[model samples]
Target: MPTLSKLVCAALTCLAVQLPAHADNTDGSFQTAPSFSWWSGDKSANNNATGGGGVFGGRSLSVDGLINSAKNLIGLPYRAGGTSPTSGFDCSGFVQYVFKHAANVDLPRTSRDMAQVGQSVSRDNLRPGDMVFFAHTRGGGNRISHVGVYVGEGHFIHSPSTGKTIQINSMDSGYWSSKFVTARRVTD
Candidate 1:
């Protein structure tokens, strides 16, 4: 029997023409091409396949790649309106940058606006690329005040606030759990 890698390669070869032109995105990153569709009943939705690993007929969305890219920015400082690695990133800016580069999806600039783009996902059902939202109860109430990328295993990465750098935090922690508002899945 052929190995799983070989089977996957053969399948990708057959589907190459149907895949989008990502020749410039060869560095283990993905770009959004709506032609890409998820396989039905995906058991690996959270698998984090490195080489565009979750598309129809072949690897198409690299959850692992997106996560890794986000991880690489762990020490960057936070700025209110920052968006790039050099200028530092705010909560939403960080999420937008990662999805745009690592996953090839352009998200809205603010966390509140970002919350509106994707489908609602319960905390229990979160996958790796799901955007998690939180609210500051004092001033936020039901309004979203923060956002992060759910990196799986109950952990998420974000630029918490001023004087803080991008860091990963737990979804189950008292602070985040209490403030949790909702989550959205913008990637497959």
Candidate 2:
């Protein structure tokens, strides 16, 4: 239920108050923020230090900003048709909100609809901020039933299904890597 600016401020406040002690982040993992715990899965494997390597993962770009904004909403709940941070968000809703609010890009409402736009990219070609899609079924006929914003390395940020909060997941291994239908570079 926290806004991006508010979250940023809160993060800054936490940083100021805890400036003397930096948590040991020696591994390629992050524990995510406390407030974010409510919204994300908070898995160390997903928050690996590599953060999912992407072609444009280096030197933050506008897309990188969008990626960061989505990552900040790590602890929001999933609402069936929700799109805002306060009410929570679904997979597509999460993608829609991030594009609209962060990059000023207007995307379709449904994950399938979104899959239709943008330039198609191979899994090996994905860059930070590209839209990644998944089909719930593994059948060749299955269509895009879910979507997320690619955040680099092999991770993505998405508001998962009911009872699940926004979280990051790996694209190189796991059910996702298998269900991945295709990726699209929605932005330059």
Candidate 3:
């Protein structure tokens, strides 16, 4: 009998060969990617890594790899609309780039459009790979100008502003709390 690890590996291998480069966009509607929740499960697996437990078994990589990749850019200068380390990044650009490279998930380019790509989720229910939006410098009811990746533990990773570096921030902080607009789950 195939073990759970073997089954997961076989499934992912089949998915890798069968899944299309882009997710389905039928009926002029976008659906959240079915593999989005894999990020949270990856994190849990890594956190449980103890005594060579082999928590991570399949070809699917861990979210810690994604988070660590993002963390490597901490202190990188911010640039408007930037998407690479050499150029720096805006909030949404940072999220898009990180997910694309680290998790191979393609996201919309702009913050507003990206907000619409995921399922609406409250901040209380946010998990890894979820997107958190904020008003940032924007004011009034038309909030939602900045975006970030929720990396767990009430913290999010984002490219804040010009002259600022990409960094992790607490959602509970007063500045973020006041500016936070909404959170969305783009993955399963």
Candidate 4:
């Protein structure tokens, strides 16, 4: 009988072989460059959830990096229409700055406008770095008025209203949960 180590390696190798096609080049070429080297190789250091081998954007910034960058602003005063760490940030301003810095992606100035783009993601399907939206109306409305970056585990980071600072809050909070709208994945 085969040893357990060999059997496990064989199983992972089979699973890795089923991965779908990947974009070939920087411009997303269709060329197929094939490899499953990670399967049989040492995986002791692999911890990335996406299974891309811990590579963030493969050279661009990773979502974790974006979360870290956003988290660094915690305690920065909230400023309406503000866009920089120095000037502080509103909800949208904070989102804009973090996306620009982390992924080189430019988001709209206001939360509502930012909601228009990107793939629509359900709140239940939220992933780290995904954008969560909200409306000011107590009962919730179609108009989105606030935004935050979902940092996984039902929490998000944002520069809340006046008198608040950039902070992370549980989306499951009574107030937020009631006003919660759909989420979007700009990084996807």
- What is candidate 3's local distance difference test score? 0.66
User: If both were scored by TM-score, which would come out higher, candidate 2 or candidate 4?
Assistant: 2
Candidate 1 per-residue lDDT, tens place, 1-188, comes to 99999999667545643546343233222222112223222445446534345442333667767776787687789999999999999899999999888756777899899989858999898877788999974765888989998876676788888887787666775467778889987564
Model 2: lDDT of residue 70: 83
User: In candidate 3, residue 157 scores what lDDT?
Assistant: 76
- The TM-scores, one per candidate, come to 0.70, 0.70, 0.66, 0.68
lDDT of 3 by residue, 81-154 (tens): 79899988988889888877866777889888888875799988776667889886634675579998776767
On lDDT, the stronger of 2 and 4 is 2
lDDT per model vs. reference = 0.72, 0.70, 0.66, 0.70
lDDT of 2 by residue, 1-188 (tens): 99999999878656633433223133222235322321233444233223433222233236545866887787689999998998989999999999778766788999999998878989897766789998885465558899998776676778778987787776776667778888887664
* TM-score: model 4 vs. ground truth: 0.68
Question: lDDT score of model 1?
Answer: 0.72
Which residue pairs does candidate 4 place in steric collision? none
Predict model 2's lDDT versus the native: 0.70
Per-residue error for 188 in candidate 4, Å, reads 2.0
Q: What local lDDT does model 4 show for residue 156?
A: 76
Clashing pairs in 1: 48-64, 52-59, 52-60
